[model samples]
Target: MQKSDYFIKGILESDEKVVAKIYNLFFPKVLSFVYRNNGQREDAEDVFQKALLQISARIKLRKLEVINTSFEAYLFTACKNLWRRELNKKQKRVTNDEVKELVSEESDMAYALLDQERWELFRDKLEQLSDNCKEVLNLFLKKVSYDQIVKKLGYTSETVARQRVFKCKAKLIEMIKADKRFRNLK
Candidate 1:
């Protein structure tokens, strides 16, 4: 059968293979989208994976029902909602029409924080890094492979890029720990 059919089957039956197929099909776009939106490649990849897990759970629990919408839309919306929830929890911003409109779902707000809160906090810190650091980390997190990173980033050598990634990540972790909003997670 075709790949599309395979993915549809996976969604319909909650089959692992189908889930994997769906991941291959749409995760790239979602990851790129997330990274472009102040998320790192790792953050995007992680969010996409967790979104799939959530989708599987919702399907199993009958909490998510997809009728006419494209699977890609459903998956993206779910991931986006999940990310917003993590942001709100970390930001702890008061509810307002403008803020509410900025988010897509409200139910996740009621659930207890999982590992997601910490990850989102980390993502926030990633944005605080210098532009070069953020770019390097984002590319590295996307699994560009060391050689590819050197090539794409215009680095003279893989070692330089690697060092930057290390320094940036270290600084990000330190900043997150120092920040009152995220210190509790450490």
Candidate 2:
């Protein structure tokens, strides 16, 4: 196994010594990344923690496998993405020059992580909706047409399916907006 695979295994097993080694080895780079992106020491720490949590979650769910990038690179990219999102939440825009410095592949991995996080959040919120709403939204997410949804869900007509989808979507949005974690992520 590669050195990074050991780190991934360590993370999966929750090995404290390995985790500490990862932090000791990679934290400085992540810190510099956050600081360069208009963040402070505390912000860097927060970003690192969030990135670690994201990585751990993915590992536990078996979502991460055969990492193509170095572990440090993946972690740093995640930190950068998290910091960028935090800055955006505060209404700050990252400059084009800063963006240009990111490796395309690393940035793509970072974005995939961010997208997965958002999708997970949305899915959690979706589960809190009524059964009919969940059904409609799940079908909609799968690109099922309204006519098909009506047939599948036994709705009266395509118009009813559309209305249900609209209402369910509105509820889902409202639930997402009301979540404290959602606010924090934003």
Candidate 3:
């Protein structure tokens, strides 16, 4: 089903299954959108997720209603906005032409199909990471140091922390590579 249709149904009725299906359906589009826009599969996944995150935040805040557009357009717009913010976070300045060049392929279909495959592979791979790896990775992203990561994550030893980080990174790389998102990178 088209995710926008599914999502509007989910929102109107608050059906968990409908919501889950919407996530599954629209994520591929968002993933392809992100990857086509100077991001990796991971970035695509993240941008897609942030689209949902924004939805949830809006729901929680009860800030405003998305009244006019299909859920698909709203979702895609959210992803695009979030990615634009991410790119802006970079220190260097980027011109409008560069930004347009990055996402131009998303206006085409072939890139979209590849993105679908990549995100499905991505979701499956995340399920394979160890609990410890996931926890440590979260801490690392929080800007914690090796010592702080070990302490906060309850690792028995720093050696264990380092190994976990290394292994987690290796696993993430392998997962991304196998998914064809980072095949060109490695």
Residue-level lDDT tens digits of model 3 in 1-186: 654555654655668887687778787888787777778888887777655655654454443344245777667766776676567754233443344423443332233333433443554466678887777777876778999887887888889888999899799768767775457323
Off by over 4 Å in 3: 1-5, 8-82, 85-123, 180-186
Tens digit per residue, CA lDDT, model 2, 21-119: 998999998888877878899999888887887788777764667655588877776777777767765553344434343346456445657565565
**Reference-based lDDT, each prediction:** 0.67, 0.79, 0.65
Mark the regions of model 1 whose C-alpha exceeds 4 Å error after superposition: 1-112
Off by over 4 Å in 2: 92-112, 116-186
Worst 10 residues of 3 by lDDT: 105-114
Candidate 3: pairs in clash = none
Question: Quick one: ranking by lDDT, best first?
Answer: 2, 1, 3
Report the number of backbone clashes for model 2: 0
